[model samples]
Target: MSAAGPRADVIDEHVAALSAALHGPARAKSRLIGEIRDGLMDTAAAHAADGVPRQRAARLAVREFGTVDDLVPSCQRELTIAQARHTARTVALTSPFLVACWYLAGSIDQGQAWQLPRTAQLVAVHLAGVATFAALFAAVALAATGTLARRLPTPRGLPLVVAWAGTTASGAMAGAALALVTAAALATDWPLLVCAGALAAASHAAVAASARACRHCARLPVT
Candidate 1:
């Protein structure tokens, strides 16, 4: 029987598995996969140039590229940062809307068309300020703890500071939420109060998730 030639299908299948481990923006993930694929093809071609069989060249390229276990950690860190960025953004974007909703609901309950009562005004201003600060801090945390920051050979104090800043921001949000809910109850704006409570709860959950992801990223070895 004649010997069978090397199968490109096997090489492509290996590349596909390797690509699945990468996580980030769709475009970036696609680019990474394409680069890996090209490199593998080039490696195989080089081996073929040297009279090595195509199947053996593909296997050699994959082996040289490292196993799936070796590739996953790096991808995992990127994925974590991506997730943190997404959650932080969610908190930042939603805070303003939630604050507006609370104010609107309170104004409606009080029969104060667009004009808020003096106490409502004060409370709204305070909540707005807190939510704004939290949003700003979310931006800071995302920037400071991204994948680029984690790639340093020697860990810097900045990551730790960013980690702490994320926790502090989350705490500030929670405290503000609690305060708003309490104030709403005292003002007897029961409907607005409940809305504020829900918003606060959701914000707290988001901040907690973001902080956790950042913490995990921070603990990863600086590579």
Candidate 2:
């Protein structure tokens, strides 16, 4: 009997053990087994292409007998946890910069003497709140995308597309926010203008930092 012949029995034993371990979830176990079988088949095909006899390659693949139902789920959970942690870190890192930008914009408005009409001042505050919320949301989305770009299984081109799109959008938003602040400066009294300008500068700095972080994250090889 060939070495390959002996391997089939070893694989069968392992599969039996896996089935026993997964006794309570037959359907899930079956699915996991199917995935393992497919992976093994792919490996066997590769081996055959590299000159192993078809029968020997099939036998060799039998070594990958056990389903990883429990293991796979645990790995998935861990991945989810890690992703959450990464997102939290990204947000924490970016928030201060955003706040600083807002403050700078406010300072610029103050410098410009932009005394708003009482109604307009209320409107401006409301708008600033909305803008801050939007900035936070955008930052979170960009950071999440950066995380996905690191983890998702995809063609090389897909990640590049996502990363570039995110970077471009971020840059554009930053530019627009700056323009709005500058316009506010021109239109308002000197104090308000100074505050707005300061806020714009802060925002620009935050966005610049975020863009750099995203680029760095994108360049990292997926683990």
Candidate 3:
């Protein structure tokens, strides 16, 4: 009983250091740390079965696991890829709903439907088209970061690419919403306009947060 204490403590300290050296999506980071802990404990047990002392076996496991410096680059890269996948997934999923927000707002409107100016109509169409292409691109990025990653080597700077791609897609969607909202301001009652505005703001805020996390992960020097 007394001997088991230091054995566990050494393993715990090593795991704590590994967890501290990594930063990314919380869920993904936690999973990685847990896997590392399991690996260490398994290795230590194998050593102890061969007549090694528990405490010494634990220390040997840490040495075989490599230093924090050696592990950071690969660990950070995986975390960054996870971040990229998350951002891409967000952009792909919410895109259609943003378009629907405009139609729904107009559908529930209490005021008369007024014809928008030709310029406003054209601009809205253009923005909607851009948003569609952006969303498609985000979907491709998501696939690349996800299923495709398992078969091929991860591309360098993929996190940065996906982060900006998501931001651009969300921004275009927001612009489309703005154009529609401004054009329909006189046609809809205050309540519907407020609803539209609130939806757009909330969606954009979520995209901004996800994109920010992507950026933070991308900026970490994996070398």
Candidate 4:
């Protein structure tokens, strides 16, 4: 009708306001905007059918979507949880690589190809590896298997627990690595120990970074 042009302009303004209020990955923001536009159009169409003027209908539709202040926090919470979930998945995928790196570094330092002694130190290191694997797996499973979606859609349990476990495991892994490197350095030359320690340190750093990111996302203010 004659109001089509003004209706489009109104929709553009609403979309712009909504877009400016959102913050997250570009893909997610785009998808959200698409949904919002669809909703706005539907609302405007409904209002038009009810004999509302086109411009007034568009404004009403925008109002129905809520103010920027009211919607921003909701969008932020969703985006933050999404970021945390993504980081958790990345940590899960990298966990095996990290474990292998730690094992390689530790074995090289111990100067033995396959010597896993029953000593207390060996037991502790093994336990730390097991704990790290378990924690990362739990996080990945929750995110991937739809369990998190069904039960605790907005809860912080999944990401927070994973971050805490990852941090604790990192500390334990670092201690074990230091002990192994020290023992090797005392028994052998420094070159091999240094190389192995560097590799272990790099791997641990990656896991730490992932966990820290997840923790930050989890703590994002929903207010």
Top lDDT: which candidate number?
3
Give the winner by lDDT: 1 or 4: 4
Taking the tens digit of each residue's C-alpha lDDT, what string does model 2 give over 1-223? 8655544454445455554533212344466656655666676677778998767776677654324454444433323333333333343444444444444444433444444332333343444554455445545554554666478633333323333433443343355355445456455444554454455445445544444444444443442
Name the runs in model 3 displaced over 4 angstroms: 105-128, 173-187
- Model 2, runs deviating above 4 Å: 1-70, 109-223
For candidate 3, lDDT tens digit of each residue in 65-112?
Answer: 998888889899889888888887787776665665555454543434
TM match of model 3 to true structure: 0.83
- The CA-based lDDT of model 4 is what? 0.62
Clashing pairs in 3: none
lDDT of each residue in 1-223, candidate 1, tens digit only: 2112453665688767866755444554666667777887788778777988777877887788777668767765555455456656665766675466456445634543433343544555565566677677667656655554577432244444444555655565565566556555555455665576567667667666666655665565433
Query: Between candidates 2 and 3, which one is better according to lDDT?
Result: 3
Candidate 4 RMSD to the correct structure: 5.8
Q: Which tens-of-lDDT digit does each residue in 1-223 have in candidate 4?
A: 4777777788888788868766554666788778888988889989999999888888899889887777777776676656555555655554554455446544534544434321323643574476467555656645643565776554546556766656665555465556446645553444544554455456467667766765765565565
Residue 153: error of model 2 in Å? Answer: 28
lDDT of 3 at 77: 88
Q: How does each model score on TM-score?
A: 0.57, 0.32, 0.83, 0.61
As for TM-score, the candidate ahead, 1 or 4, is 4
lDDT of 1 at 177: 61
Worst 10 residues of 4 by lDDT: 112-121
TM-score for candidate 2: 0.32
Candidate 3 structure lDDT: 0.75
